[model samples]
Target: MDRAVLRDDMVDSLEHEAKGWINTESVSLAMRSVPRHEFVPDEQRAYADCSFEQFGTRVLAPSTAARLVEALDPTPDDSVLIVGVGVGYTAAVVAEIVGDQNVQAIDITRRLVWEARNNLARAGYNGVLVDRHDGSDGLPAYAPYDRILLEAAAIEPPQTLLRQLGASGHLVMPLGASTQRLVSVSKDGTTVDEFGRVAFSPMLVDGEQVDTVERNRTVREDREFAARESEGRHGWEQHWIDWTHGQKH
Candidate 1:
């Protein structure tokens, strides 16, 4: 089949599955217009099933991306700050919804950032602007963002990130250590409110530091892994290896 045709199919699937999860008409239209498969790696295009990838890590399930977009509720008028810039697919997705000029995506990985920029341009989104930077710090240059979306989960809300959001701006991100919940933070001056929960991969920082928060989170996550291991005591030991889970972290 032609790649273009396959891309069209992916869009159709996104529309079908994203129906109720996403209620905004503009987002629906953007999803239909953007060819998600085009942004995905050619080798993995076979599974262009609405998922998110983190370089070599686990490919986040498509349903998760669908839900993330729903949680974000991006509009054409909103200026979006996208972190965890995976392969650039999510940025492309955002560009479709928010317009190329309104979206600004960033990632820590240099190679991934290059790939995202190239892929986005290849997908006819040369107009979409993206940069390579530390995801944890957020993009200060683009201060006062109307909407902020983090692709990775963090143990605690990054105060620095909130500082950059414009008043009344909405930030959709995953919070907590191991078990993450997709949260939307509505900025009101110095105050921010968080709501909603969804499982996601941990956000990556460049430096390595063993601190209280990191240590506690590691311990908690180890416990979660142990619990899952005990539950599958009698099952195939190999089956315990969750490829999907392994890919995200």
Candidate 2:
């Protein structure tokens, strides 16, 4: 079967009433146009509505990507930023809608950044920029994007990312710590519309990428333990000398 036919089939499933993931025509067309097989390791499974793991990051399921892009609702030629580029599949879809030159993406993991770059290029979206940067900080050099999509979960919208949104922009993310919900926030950060529950890995900070030798939390936790021990009393200090108390009695 042709890859294009496979892609059409994938989009059809997403638009079908059973899934209803692709609600808008733009998303439907974009998904169909972009060749998902070029972005995933397994061309055989590329159109499957299932997720894949690559370079320690997740290649979101087609349905999940459709939901995100639909929520993002990017317009043609809109400047868009995609945090957590993953395998660059979502970025390619967005590029189809917004033009490759109008899309910029970033990832905290260096290897994944390279992976996304290669994948995007292979998928004929070389104009889209994929950089290795902390997702929280965003790509500030190209700040004030018309639309922002965060693929990772964050406890709250990153303030820096919010600051980078254009005056009339929308930032969509899986918001929450333990229980995540897909949400879209207005540029002012006041008008938030939730689109039900989702589960995504928490956003990674510096030194927390899968390739890092030591996680940031481990070093921070060790320092915290040391500080607590220093502030605490030792064995002899814990046992009060009762000389003064006994004399008073």
Candidate 3:
């Protein structure tokens, strides 16, 4: 299928399905301008009809991503913090919404960051900046964000992220261990309120030291024997679970 035709079909189908989920002319334009196929690997282009991807599934489904952007209600004045920033597809879409100058894209994977930066440049969307950092740990130097969007999910909102938001600023993410929600947290002084249930990828920090003390708790169980063959502390055996736990409280 022709790529533009496929892109239009996805947007049209999503706009129809997301009647209550989105309503912005600019967003629709962005959907059209951003070549979704460019973000996906060559083999997966055929599956663009589906919202989720089997591999290199960086971009969210059109309707879901559209809905998330709608939830954000981004403006020219808004300074955006984009977590996960997978392949920079969503960031490019958002840059169109908020204008390129106001958007900041962050990801923990160096290669992904490199890819995202290149993708943005190749697509002619040069305003958004991609940086390598743990998504769970928001960039502090650029604190007081007017809007923060996590393409990934966290068990709970990171406190540091909350502190980084400008008063009345909105930060959205998926909350929970297994199931998740697309939650929006609008900060008010020390108080923040949340709403919505949106599923997303798990939040990941670039590099965090393992809690050897915490790991030793399982020494009495066969888990200690299980740990023997593996590299100590920060091995892949426990990285995902540790990442999940780190995002909590």
Index of the highest-TM-score prediction: 2
Please write out the lDDT profile of model 3 over residues 1-249, one tens digit for every residue.
Answer: 677777777677766754444577777788877877667665255225445543244456666777778767788758998987877777888898778888898877676788888888887778788898876678888888999987776656777788889987988776654566667886643324444676665565545212222321211223434556564655445544556556522
Candidate 1 lowest-lDDT run of ten: 208-217
TM-scores vs. true structure, each candidate: 0.72, 0.85, 0.73
- Candidate 1: misplaced stretches above 4 Å? 1-19, 43-47, 50-54, 188-197, 208-249
Report the C-alpha lDDT of model 2 over 154-188, residue by residue, as the tens digit: 76677889999999999999987668899999877
- For model 1, residues 1-249, the per-residue Cα lDDT tens digits are 765565555555656644445456665566666666656555454346644434544445444566677778877768888887666666777788778888888876677778778888888888767887777788888788888888877765667778888877877888776556777887742324444567765666664221223422333345566887887686335564667667322
Worst 10 residues of 2 by lDDT: 212-221
Better of 1 and 2 by TM-score: 2
Clashing pairs in 2: none
What do the candidate models score in CA lDDT, each in turn? 0.67, 0.86, 0.69
* lDDT of residue 246 for candidate 1: 71
Candidate 3 Cα deviation (angstroms), residue 47: 8.1
What TM-score quantifies how close candidate 3 is to the native fold? 0.73
